[model samples]
Target: MTSSNTTDTATARREDPPTTAKKKRSRELIIAQLIGQVALLLAIPVLTRLLSPAEMGIYQTGLSVALILQPLATLRRELLIPFAGVRDARKHRWIGLGFAATLSGAIALVALPAWALGNATLAETLLATALILPSFALMYVENAFLIRHSAQGRLAVRNLVGGVLSAGLQVVAALILPGAIAIAAALLLGRAAATFVTVARRTPSSDVESPGEKKSQRSISAILSAMIAAASSQAVVIVSFASLGPSAAAQVAVGQRVAGAPASLIGQALTQIALSSAAPLIREQRPGMTSQLRSLTIRTGAAAAVTAAALMIGGPLLAVPILGPGWEVAGVMTAVFAVPLSLTLVALPATTLLIPLGRERLLVSLQTVRLVAIVAAIVVSSALTQDVFTTSIVTAAVWTLAYVPLMTAAFTATVAHDRLCAQVVNQSSAP
Candidate 1:
């Protein structure tokens, strides 16, 4: 009886660990990411309440410049995470090296030109922010590593530490220093700290190589594709601000920031899981998994849309007291902005599907079209009038109108491609 009991216990242990463990880890990641995002969200309202609009404007402008330049530093190597496992280490290293070098050089090259063009403040801030791009890129690389290793727990911890610390520091700065620059600096410092922590925890693998070497044809293609996509996406935001006035642009951006927060955090977190788990699916060429992914995308998109609507309707009432007096207008706009912002969830999965399928160029092309649309709308709106609200409406309409069909098609195509590939491989291997 004793022997049988021991055998049963050992058998139970071998039956696979409790689902609770994975659920707990996943929950932690979601919570941590949310905490970080909530911190960021809080910063805006708090800072807006404390500081002048002009000051907030300055900070927002700085952030815009940072966003544009940061991607330039990456050259999209971070996007390679999903497919990196299938490639050679040497190739991956070279790709990383080339991007890092290109990004740094690109920043330096832009400095003189930007200043010569008389945008010194924007240029200088961009340059300073550019310095951190490498670190951000590195953090992304580490993120890929953690995801690939199924270390979701560690990833959650890293994000939590960074998010919570940044939020706390921003609160302190808001109360103590109460300066936009100070707030910006605090955020950056927290980012740096998080990046360092992530890097420290990542143990180097023998397969991993430093980023500097002769590039492979595949990697070269990947880089070019990602660059185009990155450039297009960045251009839209830049044009949106340029086309509409800063105030309108800021409000629209806030909507995107707020309404899209859940999708961005949760969707992004899922991408890591998707990348790690999808490997076997890809290897096995499982079409059913793609269906599952599409289902998830749809469900999430619906949820995002509903959430956006709620925020749009409820945001004004919520904002009056929470964000203080000055942000009443912004709060109102935020809700209005949520209508278009909801599409982001649908777009996320569609965009990510290209990565594992090695069709990143498709993403690039879609975004390129989106950028062209943005630019055209801006030009048309500007020609008609300098009305910020009108321009914003036009821009939002353009964005929502353009991405839906494109993303749906992209998602469907990825599923079909996976299914077809599986069939072909299975047929070829048949006895």
Candidate 2:
């Protein structure tokens, strides 16, 4: 008994370092994310004071368009990096950059027609988005590479630098240039600078190029799903900009930024950790994977619920102060957006798990449903009421409802996949 006890204690001591190291990495990432969010949060008041609602709306609309294009620009290849060998990952990075460049040129061509047609705003928005696409794509792939190697410390630094640069540049542009295009340009410059710094650092040569790592055929489905998901997430902003006009769009944008902060903080902090940790387990068909995913989902859901409740109660009161005067509507919209954003937060773990689980088709189906639901809500609301507040409420309700099925499907699929994996392992071992 004493010998057994000693062995158990020794095993625990051996395990403790890895567990502790993971915790330390998580802590650093979260703190860095928090710092970044705080910087952006602090800039909101100054931004609101400097830029008009219309200008802010245009800026946000441009951002939304860029975000929608981002997944396509990289072909979602970055998602493959964590599961890939080093050589494959390096190839993906370069290929992703090439895609971004091609897309940017295509966007520029489209913008020329807008310029010729006398839609200066549209042309500027498209051109700015075009300019930023490659930088954004580079950052995305590089970050994925970092996650592949568990370089959380470098990732933390990247996040810190990016957040600071983005916020500072935007503030300076608002002061100096005072236009939507200027704001977009600032974002592009900041992201480019951050990407440069991150890329300049040399990575360790520890990861081996395994022959067993084949390129996934699911890349096409993954890219489609990512594009659809990005568009769906930005649907409200896009629809509001088209149907309701800039002021309404601005209010929704500001509200989303403020109300979504908690979820963004939690989700971004966990996503890398989840992807890095879950990849090996899923690849190896490890036991307890399902339980680990379920526990993460439950805990994230609980945190989301508490935060959502707090935001619903206190968000409006704090919004006016944080966003400054002339933005009371933004405050109310913040409260209205709390539920949907929290639901998205709750669904993060399931979505993250789906990638390594190779459930790209399911992802595409889910995102398509969400996109249809959100677009229908926005269209119907705009036609019936033409009121921004009414539209926001309707969109939020529909978005919240849509997430129920998404969360259910994702978790159900994850469990089903885990069971199949187990069965396959059992069968192979039995013979």
Candidate 3:
């Protein structure tokens, strides 16, 4: 009986790692998502009370500009994905990225003084944004490593640490400093700290490559496509600010953050897992994977929409109570922005299809069209309605209606083409 018991214990221990990895990763992602949403919720009351609505507006607006530039500065880190599993490509990619980050940071720093001397607009904010480039670039590079390794635990840690530290610093900085400067400084510090944390805990960059995987080399065309895709991530915010001024842009930005938390939570978790799974599916030309991908896309999209709808009802109710009286305008727009967010969740799975299919040019083209539409809608709506909320309504409608069909069809077609080509190649190569 003693020998049998010992054998059983040994067997259980041996079986645990393989059996539990997926479950463990899923739990980590869920925890990370909850932390993010809860942190955002906790942050609203403190930030809004300490900083005026106008200050919040200005901070978010300037930060949006920084966000649009981030992808461009990094040469679009997503372009590094295919090579995530390859050694030579990963090494060269890192060296290139390091050089790019250094050059970009230096240029931005130099431009700061030049802008200040020239008395250019938003020089201070741009300067702060520029200072963050190196750390921010490192964050993206590490993200590729984590995804490649399926290091979901580290990814979760990265998100939780970066976000909480950043938000905490914003609170502390607000107490210690004045105006948007505190928030801007907090943003930079948070990014820098998060990058350090990710790097410190990460498996060495060299470990990201597997000897058996196909090597993917970076191309200028691929990099360009990635840059466009990354830049489009925040085009709406840029357009909103340009068309509606700081206050209106502020309200929309806040609404998107507040009202869209549920969808963001869902989207974020799905994205981490989806990217991990999708990369191999496309790279190997596995037709079997698309059915599963399609199923997941539908389920997640529906879940996001339903969750956003429920929050829409509750979000408006809580906005004033949580954010104080100044954000009542954001309250009204919060649910409004969330509608588009739920709709936008479709793009997550749709986008995962692009990397494996090697169809980034298509992705870029589609994103460009959507960016154009967003800008056009904002411009036309601002002219017609002359109100921020009204323009947002039009923009949300356009984004949802315009984006879903094109994105879904793009994924479907890309998957089908890759599968067909794989079949043809298999037959040709068959002995």
Candidate 4:
């Protein structure tokens, strides 16, 4: 055999293991997401049967509030782990816990106003936020650490166990108490259990030291961007609850959960894989980084489009049967929601690139605009029509119009930055 052929064969052998490992990890993540989605799907019918629309609205409200507040508690420091050295990552974990504790205390204080005003539901939501935030933050930090260590199998186990346990507990809660608070407590306990298992399973080898790294200035931007993004996503339900009442809010919540499920599942699984695999490449200015980003964008976008089409066609037909009676409006709302959900899913994989590309300012600006646009749509719709279906259609339309242009800009910037990085690398390596 020629020397060139032999050298090429040797290089291929060296590269094979990392390629194989990544594939295995990707499969594990996808399987884990599937299990979680299945658990969620199974629990929905039972929960819907056990709780009335008003009660479900309360439960969903509590969940939305928790999600909006969680980014504040964690400050998104966990997202920095993969890009940080080991010591920095460990420090981030502790710092994140501190943030959670401080935010919990602040949330407790906020609950006092609702209690004084005799707003029982609002007060309960704030109290639940205080209790759940710490556990959720801990779980996020641990999961981020797992990603940093390439412990995808452990992360998969964490998700599988946590998802099933949470669903089971919620079912039991519905059977006994059938209240929003009870179900919320079940969620808190589930998160705590997940964090406990993650901590216990941590291996010493995962703590290997690496070179020191500079502290990130974008932590606040990350937190703000994530917080706004979460609020924007949940705004429709929250606003519907306040303006149109529980019944409308319930429809929006159910529609989002059911119609957005497939896109969310695939987006989340691909997000994990992208963070683990693509971060290092971007960090090191490795070749094929842009290609990887482009490929993931295409794959996720296609899956999202297909899922949205199916939901638009079949969601209304199946909603009544799957979710039981009185949820017919939810079916129609599902069709309305599919478009914006698909757009968001298409942009999901590219979001993590913002920080690595030093585009945190752009990230925050885009999210802020999105939140503003969504809120404006809700307000205008409520003022003009005050009908749940009308509100949903307007909100979805506004979201689609706003997101497409913004996300196109984001994608364009990401590719341009990647090309610039390649240029610099080529310039440095030239003779």
Candidate 5:
């Protein structure tokens, strides 16, 4: 009787709703993501002014390439951060630190060849990458752990500190160095400093024991599985951009960024809050989760629509003076892209359903298909029309429209499966 009572108590504790403390954490997480995004948006104009298009093109391309390598090095250990509902902080800290260290080493190893490449542009890119790649990769686990632990406020602060400091450094460097490579290199260094400070201060310094006394806590198979899932999911949009020429890709990327900026800023903070609170919500099958998701979708869609309308009509007029003459197209792209991007609010939270359901492998499969389609569309479009802009616009529109539906469907399927399993368990327990 006592053992059964203890089990019930443990289950109840895990199934509790978002407490006042957890709500506060969520707010903090959302705020951090927004602050960082805003910093990125603000820094763009200054950075653009300091560097030429060609240099910007090289830097952007290098970033795209680096992103492909990022998931590989991290091997998806960061995803474990948000999965902390099942584990205690002590365990999370050790594994998280181990993951970060291992990922950093892997990134450095991968970056060496690019840094050694003889081409000046490649050399500059490799140098910039050497400074920034490890920092970006390292932050993943910290960010995830913070979200998992319901430390949203701390996470936000970390992101806020990193973004603001990095942006400030980039601006300062641009003013002093005033060149593409110099500015890029400076930006990398700034980001590194910010990320280092945040993780080092927040994460506990310790190692967890592996079952087999292996150097790493998680097995290679588990790590690789997670990495593959994340990599496949991240590949679609990023790889699509890479296949397109830098300038053309940059234009759409700019529009996508603008469209996503507001929501992303808002949602990121919410994401932290949501993830921290969501574990129990899922465990109890709380109605509030669905309600919150619905609310988010409506809010995001409405805001995106308004922003899109404004950009579409006022875009050309406002853009000409600010971005230069030929750049008016950016405004149009922004308008076209914003509405679709806004749907991310709905898609992102719904997608979280997969995490709690342990349907990560399925999610990865869906994303793999999405990426393949994106690449195929770009390739076919490019072959049909030699113009990069045309190909980009077509590809962007397709992706933007499809994002919400795909995620929504995926979540729905997951929810259905969970319900069926729960029903079976209830029947089995019936006396």
Candidate 6:
């Protein structure tokens, strides 16, 4: 009787939700991500108080440009994280770092024309940004490493420190000197600090190249797809700047930053967390993990809905007063953009499959669609209405509308692929 009772107790314990699920790593990453994003959210109000709307616009424009460049410079390095485990891409981590350094140098040389052309200030900022690009790649590697190792405590602490340092410095910079370059400089300093603590600690010998088979974490199709998708994402902002002009461009950038906090924070964090958490489940032939990811995605979307409602109702009220009366439009735009940003929770989680499943081809295809929709909306709206907020709203709407179907397709594909793989493994091992 006691043995039967013990079996029953064991089964009950196994079935219990709390016992069955901890999501400890996910929780750590979320906390870390929350700190970083919250800092940015808080920074927006304070920054607007210190900098004029035009200055704010200039800062975001420069940032948007740098954001695109950063990825382009380290495209391969970013790909190196997952491929780090792949035998074919051996020694690629080191080679990729070398390539990043070379690209940054080439970028600086390319930016030199700005000085000759009499855009000295823009030139200087871009130059600083160029130097900062390598740090961004290294920072990404550092974060991915923590996830790879399941070093949750280290990751959480690093994020907290990075976020606080970033926020504190931005506040100081805005108060002391209000300009686009000052903001950019402060941003660079924050990233540099994070990179120093995170990546700089790895020994040079650790990155030594391996010469062997040309195996890869992903196929050529996957790599090309990731590259194109990444480039398009960067291209969107550049295209926005060209199409909408600086102030309008700033409105889009700032609105997304403030309004899309749920997606940027929760959505992005979950995606990053999924890299560490879900990749193994898929590799180990675990049953039902994809379903779990889908369920989690839905829960996150519900929470994001709540966050969007709060931002939409409360954002403008707090924003207008805090950011000063002149920048009221930016705040209003932020509120307007919140709804679409809420839906991004689904899209973001869906993106996780691209890395683990080598669905880079699918990602490129989907993002190509998203990119075209975003740019078309910006271009068409800016041309017709000549209003930044209108263009921004239209663009956000398009992103939301397009991404729902995209995410659904990706999620469906991911589930089907995993299930098929599971069946294959079961069949092969049976013999």
Number of the predicted model whose lDDT against the real structure is largest: 2
For model 5, the local distance difference test gives 0.57
lDDT of 6 by residue, 1-431 (tens): 99999999999977887533447656877888788868866888788778776667666665655555554555544444543544323355555556667877776787689889997655654665565566555556566655544455666766766767777888899899887667666766786687567642344553553332124555454445545544444444456556655555555567667776677665556766666556556555555656767787778778878888898887778766766666666678778778777776766666656655656667667777777777788779988998766766787678678766667767776687678878977998895
Model 6 poorest 10 in a row by lDDT? 206-215
RMSD of 6: 4.3
Clashes of 6: 2
lDDT per prediction? 0.61, 0.78, 0.65, 0.77, 0.57, 0.65
Clashing residue pairs found in predicted model 6: 88-215, 91-210
Leading candidate by TM-score: 2
Model 3 residue 187 CA deviation (Å) reads 3.1
- Residue 415, model 4: lDDT of 77
TM-score of model 5 vs. true structure: 0.74
Q: Once superposed on the true structure, which residue ranges of model 5 sit more than 4 Å away at CA?
A: 1-25, 85-117, 179-252, 282-292, 324-329, 417-431
- Model 4 C-alpha lDDT per residue in residues 1-431, reported as the tens digit of each score: 69999999999999899789878878988888679667866898899999878778877776777678777787787788777777777788788888888988898799899999999767766776676677578667778877878778878887777777878888999999997767767876876786677653446876665433334657788788888988988998888778767667888888887877776555666667777776666566655656777788788777778888988988899988989998898889889999888766767667866765667778888889989998998888878996767877888888887766556665676677678778978999999
Residues 324-428 of candidate 5 have per-residue lDDT tens digits of 545555666666555556666656656645545556655665655665665676678878997656765666666665575456764575556556657766887
For candidate 3, write residues 279-304 as lDDT tens digits. Answer: 66555555555665677768777877
The predicted structure with the larger lDDT, 2 or 4, is 2
By TM-score, highest first, what's the ranking?
2, 4, 6, 3, 1, 5
TM-score per model over all chains: 0.79, 0.92, 0.81, 0.90, 0.74, 0.83
Pairwise lDDT winner, candidates 5 and 6: 6
lDDT tens per residue, model 2, 1-431 = 99999999999999899889988988898898778767767877888999988888887787778878888899877788877887777778788888988999898899899999998867876877787677678667888878777678888888778878988998999999887878777777887787678763444653565444546647777777777877876888877788778778888788887788786665666777677677776556655566766777788888889988988888788877778887887788789999888776777656856766778888888889888888888778878997777877888898888777767776776678678778877998995
Error of 3 at 56 (Å): 1.8
Name the better of 2 and 4 by TM-score.
2
